[model samples]
Target: MTAVEFDAPAGLTGRGAGVPLSRWAAQWGMAVLRLLRSTLFVGIPVVLIATIITYGLGALTDTNPAAQVLGETATPADIDRMNHYFGLDRPLVVQYLSWLGHALTGDLGRSYYTTLPVTDSISQALPVNLSITLLAVLIAVLLGGALGIGAALSGGGWFDRGVTLLCSAASTVPPFVIGIGLIVLFSVTVPILPSGGYVPFSEDPGRWLRFAILPAIALAVEGAVAIARQLRTSLVGELRENYVTGADVRGLTKLRVVFGHALRNAAGPAITVLGYSIPQIIGAMVVAEAVFNLPGLGKLSLDAAGKGDIPVIQGVLVTMIGLVVVSNLLVNAALLRLTPHARRQQP
Candidate 1:
């Protein structure tokens, strides 16, 4: 009989565990540092370049010049005052630096058309836009995801075929066209809902939902169809995996196996698609706002364009860019959190 003994390393009781723990902590710290550096190094420069371009374009397209073209009501002195007021009289580089500095300090300047603080304008309008967009997205996600689940489960039966057809039809129609059609049907002929304008949720909280319902539906249709298609594809892929087959073999209820197990696992990629959809939804805001005549940021931006109001245009552009950048960053962060594989990667 032979006796076998295993030798342990000195100072290694629980030390190996501490090593991996420390390594993980250091990795997370480096990730945070890289994020901050990227924001400062890459994002700052992009913001600077965007500011310069926007400011230059603002100066070039000012109401002063266009007003001059239209035979100005204001005298040369008044025009000069206006230019100075907007910092348009400065050298382009200086103007950019000054604007960038103000921006970093939370100063977005005034609306050229309204002569009101840009911040005030945004504060007044953003809520309405945000409300409408959020409602639309919620509707899209619920309806789309359910339809996708049904379609995937049916696997090309009549119900799946019908859903696919509906989505295809929806994807073909432009949001603006949808808005107009809904307005004609519901607002003009049926007279069931308001065609345009916003009623603050506080003013008549009940009316707010009805007022937004039509436009929200119109706005949501395209997004819903797109989301549904993506979800269905992902669900189908997930269903074919071995784990799902094993679940099916275990005598689990079909609904539980599909919804609880397969569908949830498939949701990761679908959520990523939904994240990218945020910007597209924002882009739709412009058309939806104009068509609905909603008192929202989109309408404000468009009015600025019509008047060639440089300050307002610049403010709107900066706000939209900020939204897009923030949305992308947040989506990436959420994805990284949800996907464990992403967080463990080398920088």
Candidate 2:
């Protein structure tokens, strides 16, 4: 008898193989393209519809843009002249098309109140809102994840009961109410942090953090409670699955079985909870920003709406819609990375 030997293919033999690298590259490229296509498919129609509604709102209202710009003392002739200058005399379809074109090109028009470009106001205010929101989200994720994991590991003990009770109580309280309480406790009682007012990070990072902490905490409370509840439930369920038993039987350490296996499996619903919380956080910012005296987009929109500053209002709303869309895109990308099922189902 003759013994025969065969060599394995290069791709099967090593991580350095060209075929595997090319296959990985192709998969990543396809995933990115699909993500982009999905974003555009959803974003374009949403923006178009939102813009149409926002533009039509001005026409529906009794308030005239010209009157808003020119003030109460302006004569009818003056208002008419101003309207013509703004091309408001044109057909609705024409006006909308023109505005859409300019918006697409990054021109949101001048504010009727300030006579400054709407983009300028949004640009100045967007950072403050983003800072507060991002900080709040970070705080929520970290604190919530910790509490949830701890409670799950506690196995229906005192810690789990306490966390559940805390979440229930916290969920009932509004962000503004929490903001006021934080102000009393941290700002007034201890006198360590400022009660209100935003400092730009560029001007002073320390002061910016000082001013941001309270409002961020207030905004974080609701999200934290929500995440805690969701994650605890998911983790508890995951820990009971047959796979966990298999891991234990394989002699995997308790910590490894819980975190490395169970946590990852349980994270999908928690991620979804986090993603849905973002828009709620944005909405809550109106009260949070007002409470904190932060000159953010919420305040900008509120002030603009009260004064009938249509252009500014439109700009702020559209900017918010864009933010929501972007956040959802990020969430989708994160899911693709974390969830095997999502990756398998990807187009």
Candidate 3:
């Protein structure tokens, strides 16, 4: 009698402890490359088009950039000279190309009001805003997922009904209104958390969290509610599927049927919804930042608009477009991993 075992091919063999890590790594690497290709193919044209559109709108405005730069009292000759100096006299396409080139090189132009480089302002403010938005989004997704799974597993009891009602009501409330309510509750009554302000996380993470909490709540609640509702629906539908019935019929344990099978199947649509919510999250952060008086990208954009600081505004919008593009790319790559059909298509 003889015994022999076939071994995996070297490349297919897992690199460490027989864990199949190499296989996993290969899948993730392909996903990353796909993300890069999508970003390059789609993101670049979107930015260019946005630049052209924004620049054109700004150029066509009745408000004079020269007047904004100098003063209303500047003479006609002064205005002409100022316009020429700023290259507003050049063809619109030339101006856009010049600005785009500078932007690509990290020269987003000087703020007409601040005289500081717009790119520098964006770099400084963007991280803070990103921190808040990212935190809020994390909170929303985690809490929403928990609530949904809990409700789904509850099997339509009081808990499920109550959760559904709560999510519905919360989703209908505007984020600003929620922010105000949170402020009144936490700041005025409790007087615990800071109302709103920016603190560098490096300097004091505690202070940063305290300052960020209220705004994050306001920004997170509505999204959380919507996510909860969506996930609950998806989970419920997944539970009703024939595969789930077969799992139960085959005597799989309750936990395995519910989580291992049902939740796994429900995740794809929930992820798709979450991916599409990134822009809305950014928009909500703008309002939340303004309400909280945080010195974030949103606040910078708001103030720049108020002062007619077109360059800064342009920088902010461009930054937002980049954020959305990158977010979409990451989301799509992640989707490929979680979705069987998508992975099949990729290979």
Candidate 4:
């Protein structure tokens, strides 16, 4: 080839490669910054709102503040001293502001029930709650997805009707009722499983699984049923889409046509349902935890609320609100990423 032609082709190829590289670099940079904004910027306002509501309610209430700092025999002076010590004497707004300031810095204050720092207790307990929640979500997604896909493929036939009816029956029952039923069935009649109560997995792996299995299953039923129905509907919709028809006409196997070609497209609507399900799942976990006596966040929050433990209650609320907010943001981001049309419209 001539030197001129060679140089021209090389230049053109290099420029083409550079364009995509520059575009990708820009996209990557934007994604990183967006994540940071999502985590720190967006999360802060939500936490503040939670703080305002939590501390605001705490101030207006006449609940025992943080496990009675004053002794039974303490005089008025001692009570005053105690109030001053815990900043209970301060104005409501001022106290909230102080709490807000400390909270923003990750200082969740002291717990009345535990005499331990609120931050420490939450830090220890959070992993447990988070682990349970995650496991439950995992279970829901897998089993729910399977049941949903199977039902959709069966198309209201025997398998489909049975699965759908089973989920309906399960969902109709409350978590506590289900937990009690399972406990009675397994622990009373069958004597196969422990009745209730948590054991550290580290202490005894077998007991941990045995105890957690029923609670996790009980907690998952609602989400599982909901997700499954949504998935079945979504899959049906996907199957109706023209693209799915085109795929089938192209001679793809039924399994490939259904799963490989259609399932991903089916996931878009299901994702939305999953997004909404987050809070509901957490609420369900409360009863499930109570029934099982699992020391997860649900039980902790209940204990906090029952005793009017402001610090613990605030801590739990903030954590859950933060989780939900972040989850929602993530869902939005994922949806936008998955559906290019949405991202293109956003600056």
Which tens-of-lDDT digit does each residue in 1-347 have in candidate 2?
33333322221222223446766656656776787789889988998898889888878988887887788899999999988877888988898898788998999988876789999999999999899999999999999999999999998999999999999999999999999999999989999999999999889999999999999999999888888889999999988877677667667799988877688777778888998888888889989988989999989999999988878988998899898889878987776566544443565
Where does the lowest 10-residue lDDT sum fall in candidate 2? 7-16
Per-residue alpha-carbon lDDT of candidate 1 for residues 7-28, written as tens digits (9 for 90 to 100): 2221112222345777756655
Q: Write the per-residue lDDT of candidate 4 for residues 196-313, one digit (tens) a residue.
A: 7777767887877787788777777778888899989988877776665665666668898776657765766667777777667666777777777777777777777877778888
Backbone clash count, each prediction separately = 0, 0, 0, 0
lDDT of 3 by residue, 151-239 (tens): 88777998899899898788789999999888899999999887788897888989889988788878888768777888888889877
Best-matching candidate per lDDT: 2
Q: Global lDDT of each model?
A: 0.74, 0.84, 0.79, 0.72
Question: Once all C-alphas are superposed, what RMSD does model 4 give against the true structure?
Answer: 7.3
What is residue 143's positional error in candidate 2, in angstroms?
1.1
TM-score of the candidate numbered 3? 0.84
Local error of candidate 3 at residue 12 (angstroms): 19
Off by over 4 Å in 1: 1-49, 62-74, 345-347
TM-scores for all candidates: the values are: 0.82, 0.88, 0.84, 0.82
| Model 3 steric clash pairs | none
Off by over 4 Å in 2: 1-34
